[model samples]
Target: MGQNSSQGARMTSSVRVIVVGAGCRGEIYSQFASIHPERVQVVGVADPRKFARTKLQQKHKILDENIFEDWHNIVEREKFADAVLICTPDRLHKEPAVAFAKKGYHILLEKPMATTAEDCTAIVEACTQSGVILSVGHVLRYDPVTHKITELIDAGVVGDVMHIQHLEPVGFYHFAHSFVRGSWRNEAESSFALLAKSCHDIDLIHHWAGPRRCVKVSSFGSVSHFGKENKPTGAGNRCLDCSIEGDCPYSASKIYLNRVKQGHTGWPVSVICPSSLPDIESVTEALRTGPYGRCVYECDNDVCSNQGELSCDGHEVHVFDFLTQRSTKHKAHNDAPRNFGMSGHGGADYHLMAAFISAVANNDPSHIRSGPEETLLSHLLVFEAERSRLESRVVYCGDAGRR
Candidate 1:
């Protein structure tokens, strides 16, 4: 089959797409849409936050009529779109996805598909029933370097996959900015760090190791550094209000001010100052008062700063959050030397999207590598691992256990 005909129709024009959750990932997806207009067109965006939606429209030059605050509003009014990109928080993925799938729309869903296995199954069922293509966002599987590693392993370049070690050095400032003081701080609102952050790692491990039955799994994590007990004495209630804001490295004002200075704009900035707190003074004040600027130690943040060790089959995988530093490295079985490391976004998102676009254009499931079923298997493994860690017992990989 050629790269443009799932049904008998040749796709001569762009595929219409609606992007939900105009946050950080949404912006990136919008940029990709702009770059690949022939194959993808971002015709609509849905986000509840006024500032977020406005920023997405302005950044992408999308028309006001094409923007929506409520995702359901868009689904109810618009009859069709080739696909819907769900970039909402981990907890918010299900509803929009279920709705879109039922409408027979192909979906490019963000990672950690949903908080639980049931939600993930529901999404898979919805898409299956409607005959829509459902591709979960497991971007790492598509990354160039990662893909090379996988290819090498598949081709017997890597000796029989023995063990895999993956390290996600959740950077110091990044931990404070996103995981600690950011939107993902609370478990109820988001999820455990494993599910919210390292679903990619779990997915990658599953891809490399094949469906290995999880023999034993355990994890231990806690909000070690970012809890009230760790709050510094004399720490003010807010960053702007704090007397030692300049001395603190995790200061929201300092971090975002630098982000803006470097032309790094989007969800990170809008998250700190969601409204017109127009001037720098207001912005700083807003950060101090807003959720983003609160003292990491004093805030209501409940997610862990350090989670460690999940073993599947005999392959033990370890994940850590060094809140005081930033570094990332992964070692997978491959024909190559095996040691691989990278500095930035880890190329996960870039790779994942490329594969999804290619798969859609090609209209082949094999081309669409990261399907909901495979990704869900990895997600279930993580959930089981967390359970084992909490209950202090071995947990198996549900029905999707190693085939």
Candidate 2:
């Protein structure tokens, strides 16, 4: 209900930020600080990975003294920046978020606040008690396509949204690289695949489904593919040694090495190799030894490949399986109409970054579309959906008395 535009735009100043993780999300969001140097500045950074830390430092020109391997080194010390951007892995979010929030650093915490509800509550409490601005990375709200669709629904252009069908289409190689062979491969290591990957979709759908609170929820899914039973008969544990790897679509060599050949050295490549610009030799060596080298079917992964019937507030939502065939990055057509159709997912990333900065700059929590309360609602849906999936029964999603 408050002003959405930058009416109080601070044209002459910038909000200082300290990036606590130099991974993809952290690095990309921090680029906003660089892009709008007049509105934001990167004063500090903390990331454990040498390559990621160095890449961000060189990009932002952060002083050597301001960069550290651990977030505690800065959060434990004096409050150095106006904001702390926490893009650490799923399991690592709570502590840095709580630490920074308590220190009066407004936070930009990544999605799925935490794996457990308790940790999420603790973080929300910390931010509320500290009187800090806490915004979640629900980038869909900032996405133009999403906004257009939301406007259409609200304006009655598409009539009523009685039922919503949303597909995440977590592409094949991407699934194998991240869910099967990468950091989010296991539930224990990171989180349920739903919370880790598709919380944005949940929040987006909920936003579009306004006024109608989710009264009931249910879900059904499993590790439908990419397990030991699905492994090729002649395949070994690692792709480098497997004689049948050339025929395997899920081969790490086929994915990462192909990226190497195509001059793709950033994300999926950097994740496997230890360097920013990885060489063929380093990638091959990594395939021979690292987690990325493991056969998708033979790894310790347990998250579901395709989730079905993820009903939120009694509305059925479909979450698709990861593809192993063609890979598609979140891209937009150059000539596409801006407000008429969909924009690629990548565009929303920076838009969310800008929205957060503007909110901080103007001291308006209303500027960021997804605040702590809305984020926690989506997280609750994630947990309830998972519970319903495992328990084989419909679950109510009301806040308190309805439950």
What TM-score, computed on C-alpha atoms, does each candidate reach? 0.82, 0.87
lDDT of 2: 0.78
- Per-residue lDDT tens digits of candidate 2, residues 1-403? 3333323356446889999888878877887665567888998899888888998899889999999999889977887789989999899999989989989999999887988888988899899999999999887676555655565567665466789887777778889898999989899989998888888888887888987778788888899998889888999989989999999988888899888888877677877775646878889889888899998988898888886323222112222324444432222212212232122243666667667888888787878788888788778888888888889888887655263
Query: Which pairs clash in the backbone of model 2?
Result: 171-323, 172-323, 172-324, 214-313
273-371 per-residue lDDT for model 1 (tens digits): 655533455556767567776887777788778873333321222234356354433453322111111111444454455556665655645556678
Which candidate leads the pack in lDDT? 2
Model 1 residue 190 distance off true place after TM-score fit, in angstroms: 1.4
Q: Ten-residue segment with the worst summed lDDT in candidate 1?
A: 335-344
Query: What is the RMSD, in Å, between candidate 1 and the native fold over all Cα?
Result: 7.7
Candidate 1, lDDT over the whole model? 0.71
Q: State how far residue 292 of model 1 sits from its true place (Å).
A: 1.8
Alpha-carbon RMSD of each model? 7.7, 7.0
